[model samples]
Target: MPVLSRFALLMLFCLSLVLVGGNSNELRAESRPNVLFIAVDDLRPELGCYGASHIQSPHIDQLAASGLLFNRAYCQQAVCSPSRTSLMTGLRPDSTKVYDLDTHFRKTVPDVVTLTQQFMKHGYKSIGMGKIYHGSLNDKASWDAYPTVRGRGYQLPETLAGIRERTKGLDVKKMNWRQRSKLTRGPATEMADVPDKQYRDGAIAEQAIKSLRELKQNQQPFFLAVGFLKPHLPFVAPQKYWDLYDRRQIKLAENRFPPENAPKFALTNWGELRNYSDMPAKGDLTDEQQLQLRHGYYACVSFTDANIGKVLDELQRLELDENTIVILWGDHGWKLGEHNGWCKHTNFENDTRVPLIIRAPGMQAQGKTSEALVEFVDIYPTLCDLAGLPLPAHLEGTSFKPLLSNPQRPWKPAAFSQYPRGRVMGYSMKTDRYRYTEWQDRKSGKVVDRELYDHRQDGAENDNIAGQPDQKRVVKQLSAQLKKNWKGAVVPD
Candidate 1:
C-alpha cells in the first residue's frame, strides 16, 4: 500500500466526522420552543396594560409588560365560532365560510390545516383543554388530545356546579305556565361561596397546571392551548373574586345607546343577555342593575386574571418560561351595555377590537407596545416563522415576525373584520384613526349601508359620520379600500 493512499483515506474520514458533527449542531440550534397559548373569552381591552388603570388585571398586566402588546388587534368576526375559526385556520371568515356559530369550517373547507395541527405535523404534541373552538366543534384531527370544550370545561364539585345545572333548565318551553308564572329570577351575577375549583375555569386552570408539570418530562415539544371561559355569560365566579371589586365604584357604560344616525341593524338583538333569567322581559336595565352587571363582569375578569397568574406561576416554577413562547389573546371584545348592546356580533369598535399579547423568548420585543394594525389570522404564520416551520401557502395572513423585534416596523396598513346579520354582511376596516364599515346584501352583493366612525375624537364610536356630507369623501376612500383586492378576489368593488 502507498503512503499517499493511506493519507487520502484518513482525510476522507475526518471530513465525514465534520459533516455529521455540523448536522448535529444545526439540529440542536433549531429545536423549536414550546408554546403556551392562553385564550380568554369575551375579554375587552379593559385591562391595566391597555390603559384601563382602574381594572383589576394585575396578572394580564404583568404578562403585557413582559411582552409586545398590540394596540390595534381585530378579530375577523365579533362572534365566538367565526372569530375562533378564522384565527385557528389562518383564514378570513369569508374564506372559511364560517359566518355563524352553527356552521363548522370543515363543512366548507375540509382539507384545511389548523394552527394546532400545523405544529403537530412538525412533531409537536398539541393539547387543547378548554373553549379553544366554538361549542363541541373542536376538531379531533387537530390534536393529540382534545377534550370537548363544553361539558367538562371545568371539573367543579357537585355543589359548585349547581348554578350551572340551573342554567341548563333555562328552556322556557320546558316549564309549564304555572311554573313559568311562579319562576323566581335570580340576578345575572352570582357570587357563590365556593372554592375556586367549584367553577369550570378554576378546574381548567388546575388541569393546565398539571399539564405543565407533566410536560417537563416529555421529550417532544408541546403546543398547549388553555382557554379560559370567563367574563362571559352568567358572569359567575367565586365569592372571593366578587369581593375584589366594589359595586359602587364600577362605572356604567357611557354610550348606553347605539351611535347617532347609525344603521338600524348595526347592533345585535342583545338576545344573549336577554336569555338570562334575571334580566327583565323588555326595556333597558335600571341604573342599579347596570352597575351590578358591570361589577359582576369586573369580578369575573379578576377571577380569570388570578387563574392565569396561577398557571403562569406554575410554568415559571417548572422552568418552562425560559424555553417557551407565551401568547395571550381574547376571542373578541364584549360590549357590556355599550351602544345599547350586550353580547358580541357587531362590527363596532367595542365588539371587534381584541387584546393580543405575544411574549417570545430571547426578549426581542419584550415590554413594548406596537400600535401596528394586526389581525387574528396573523397568529398562524407568525408562530410558524418563530418556530422555523414552513408556512402553508394557503394562509391569508402575513407573518408579523419583523414587528416582533422592532414594534414600529412597516406592517399592514389596516386590519379587517366582518359580521353577518340575517341576509346582510357588514365589512369593516380599521385604519390609523378610523373604522369604516359597509353592509351589503348577501343575495345581491349590493351595498346597503355605510358607517364611518372617527376614532381620533370618539374612540368609543359614539357618532356615525358616514352620513355627514363633510365626511363623504373619507367614507368613499375607505369604502374603496374595503372593496379592493382582498388577496385576489375583490369584495365587489
Candidate 2:
C-alpha cells in the first residue's frame, strides 16, 4: 500500500478508541449520585422511628422510612469538634489530635483530605452551611462555596422587653451582638413565637433549598450539607413547636442520680446546665424544672424536624430526589438527666450513641433497621463507596455499604468512644451487649479506673459493675479488645 493510505488507516483506529473511552467515562459520571447531608446538633434517638412515638419528628420519621436506620451508631467522642472532625476526616479522635473543642484537625493532619474535599476533588460542587463542624468551626478547603457567617443552629431572639425583665439592674440590653453573646443568659429554655426564618437553622434550610435548585441546573453533581441546631443549649424553638406536646405528659429521665459504683469523674456534675442563670449552681433541679426542660428539648427537636422537611420538600419539587442520596445524622447523643448527666461529656451510652439514617437512590433495604455496631469514622469511606470513587488507604473506617444492602450482615466487633477529664482519658468500646471503659492516666499511660455497663440488663447505663468479682472474666475479654483496637500514643504531662 502507499504511505498515505497506511497513515489514514492508523488515524481511524485511534479515533475509534478515543470515542469508546469517552462514552464509558460518561456512563460512570451519570451513575454517581448527588448527596444531601443533614446534621442535627445534640440530638438523641428519641424520635418517632426510634420508638419515641410522643415526639413530633415527622420529617425525620419520613426520612427514616425511606432508608435504613442504624440502631447503634456512636461517635468517636461525645463532644462536638472531636466527633465532627473524626467523621469529616475518617479518623478517630486520638488520630486527629482533636479531642478538645479548641483544636482544629489540620493542626495534626494538615494534608489530610476531608470528606467534602474528596467529593469536590472529583468534579462535584460541594456546598455547606450551618453546624456541619462545631459552631463557628469549619474546614475552609472542603467546600466549593459556603456562607461567610455559617449561621448559628438556633437564633431565636428575645424581645427587648423580655431582655429588660431578665436583666432589670444591668445594661445588657444595650450591648452589641458580640457583647451580648458573652453575657450570662437567664433561662435554660426559651419559647419564642416566631417564624422558622427568624432562627439560624431555618435560614440555613432556605440557603440549602436555593442551592439545590441552582445545582440541578448545573452540569456537575453536587454535595449539599445543611446542619440544623436544635434541642441543644437554651432549648429555644418556635412557640408552635412547643405547643405540639403537653408539658404534663412529658417524661423525665428514669435515672436522675449517678450510677452505683460509678467513678467520681465518670459522672459529669451538670456543669453545662449550671451555666444558665435559672439552673441551680449547687442543688438538684426541681420536678417542675426537670419536666419543663425536657419539654423545651422536645419542642426544639420538632422545630428542627419541620425545617428539614422544608429542605426535603424543595428537593422533590426540583425533581432531584431520584438521583440524590440522603444522609441524616446527629453529631452525638445528649443526656437529659440520664445517669445524672445533663450533657454529653462522658463515655456513657446516652452520650456516645447517635442516630444515623442513609437513603440511596435505589436502595435494596429501604425502611429497614440495622442493629450493627458502627462508628462515625466509617462515614467517609461509605460515601466513597457509594460515589464509586477510589477509597483512600489512610482512612481508618470500614465501608458500610454492605450493611445498607444487608442489614443483618456480620459487622464490626464494636464501636469506640473516648473523652478526657482533667488528667485522665477514658477509652470506651461498645460491643453488642456491653460498654467497656478504661480511664488511663495521661502521663503514665496506666489504667486509673474501669467501668463496665452491660446493655442487656441496664441499657440506661445505670451502674458500673467492673469491680464485681462475678464478672471478672467478661471484663478481661473486653479490656483485651480495647487495647488491640486503640493504637495511639498516650498524651503526656
Candidate 3:
C-alpha cells in the first residue's frame, strides 16, 4: 500500500460526506407538511355530514370523515371580503376595518401579514388560484404563483344575449361592479348540459390538480390555496349535477315567514337576489321559486363536491395526501329562503354558520365532530400551530389545535360574529344554547335593536324572545358576555 494512494482515497471520502450533508438539508426542508387550503364561496353547513340527508356532498363528507369537522363554526362576517379578510389576517373585522366587498384589508392594515404570507415567511411556496380574496382584490405579495382562472357565469347563449340586451343602452364601463352586476344579471339559476370544465369551479380544480403535480416535481413544501366559486349566485351547474336531485323532493324552508316580533331593520331586503332577472322586485318569492332556488343550491353544492373530489384524487395519486394539511372552508354562509331571506346580509344562524373541515397529517380525531365554538379568525393561528410556526403578534384569535387531538374537550365559551346594516352594526354572540345580537348605531354607539334566539327551543331561529318578560334574565347575561367580545372568548392555555 503506497502513501499517495491512501491520501487520494481519503480526499474522495471527505467529498462524499459533504454531498450527503447538503442532501440532508434538502430532506429536512421537505419534511414540513404541505397545505391544501380549499375555499368555497357561499356554502352553509347543509350536507350529509351536517345532517342534511338530501344534499349530495360525497366528497365533502369524505373529507369530514378523515378530519375533525367543526359543527359549530361561525364566520366573523356573513359576507365575502370581510369574512376572508378576518380569517386570512387572524384579525376581526374591526381590526382589519374591512366590512364591505369594495374595501380592501390592505387599505387599513398596510403592514399586516396574511395567512399565506406567514407561511411564505417560513419557506413555504404559496400558490393561489380562483377566488381566494374577494373578486379582484387579491394580494400579489402573498403568493409566489397567483393566477386568476375563471369562466363565464352563464354558459347558455340565450343567457348571454339576455344580459347584453338588458345592458344595451347603459355604459357598463362607467359603472362599478355592483351597478354593472344589477343591470346585466340574468336568471337566478341555470342548468346547462356542459362539462364540468365549462364552469369556473371545474377549471379551478383542474388548475389545482396541475399545480399539485408541479409542486411534487419541485420537492418543496407548498401552501396551495384553491378557491371554488359555486353555490354562490346564479346557481349554474352542469346538467348532471342538476339531475342528481328531483325538484319535487326539494322542500322549501318550513318557516318561511320573518321571525316573530323581530325588528324590521334586522331583516334584509335581500337586494342581492332581487337583482336577478327571474326574481320579483318587491315581493315574497313564490313557493315554486323557493323550491327551484333550493334545488339549484343543492346542485351547485354537488357540482363543487365533484370538483373537490378531483383535486383530492390528484393529491392522493401524487402521494401528497399523507404529507399535506388539507383544509376546506366556506368564505361564509348563504340563506336559501330562510327567514324570508335569500342572501347573507343578516346575522342569522343560517347566514353566519359555515362549513369547516380540516384534515391534517397524523391527527387522532379522524371522523370526529367537535361542537366547540370556533370562529374564522382562529384559522390563521391554528394553521400556524399545526405547522409548528409561532403565532403572529397581530393575531386576535386563539388556536384550536388542541381540539384536533381531543375533539370533545371543553373549548371556547362563545363565538362572535357581526354584520353592518347601514349605520348600524349587529354584533352577535353564540353560546352553547343561545344566539344574542345587539344592533347598535355605528356613530353614536347606541343599542337600538336587540335579538335573542334560544337554540334549545327554536333551532330554526323562527322566534325572537329578546323582549319576552320571562327571558329578561337570559338577555341580560348574554348582553354582558357580548361586551367581553373576542378577547374574553379566547381559549385557555
The candidate that wins on TM-score is 3
For model 3, the stretches where C-alpha displacement exceeds 4 angstroms are 1-28, 168-174
Candidate 1 residue lDDT tens string, 1-493: 8999999998987775564342322222236789999999999988989998768899899999899999999899998999999999999988999987678899998999999998887778999887899865778888898654322222335523554466465875676544442333334677777788768888888889988888889988899999999988778888888887777777888889889889976887885677566787688889988888888888889999999999999999998898888999999999888998788889999888999999988868889999888889889988877876777888998777787889887767688999888999899999888999899999999999988988889888988889889997888788777888344221111
lDDT (Cα, tens digit) per residue for candidate 2, span 48-142:
99999999999999989989999999899998899999999999988898987778888899999999998877778899988898855688898
Cα distance off (Å), candidate 3, residue 451: 0.8
Clashing pairs in 1: none
The alpha-carbon lDDT assigned to residue 332 of candidate 2 equals 93
lDDT values, one for every candidate = 0.83, 0.84, 0.89
In the range 1-493, model 3's lDDT, one tens digit per residue, is 8999999998887765554342322223456789999999999999999999999999999999999999999999999999999999999998899999899888899999999998887778999998989986888888999876767789999999988988888889899988887887899999999989989898899899999999999866899999999999989999999999999898888877899989876798884888898988898888999889998999999999999999999999999999999999998888888787887977899989999999999999999999999999889988887886667799989888899999889889999999998899999999999999999999998999999999999999999999999999999889888997645395765
Estimated TM-score for each candidate = 0.88, 0.89, 0.93
**Model 1 global lDDT (CA atoms, 0 to 1):** 0.83
- CA lDDT of 484 in candidate 2? 86
Question: What's the lDDT for candidate 2?
Answer: 0.84
- Once fitted onto the true fold, the runs of candidate 2 whose alpha carbons sit more than 4 angstroms away are 1-27, 148-184, 487-493
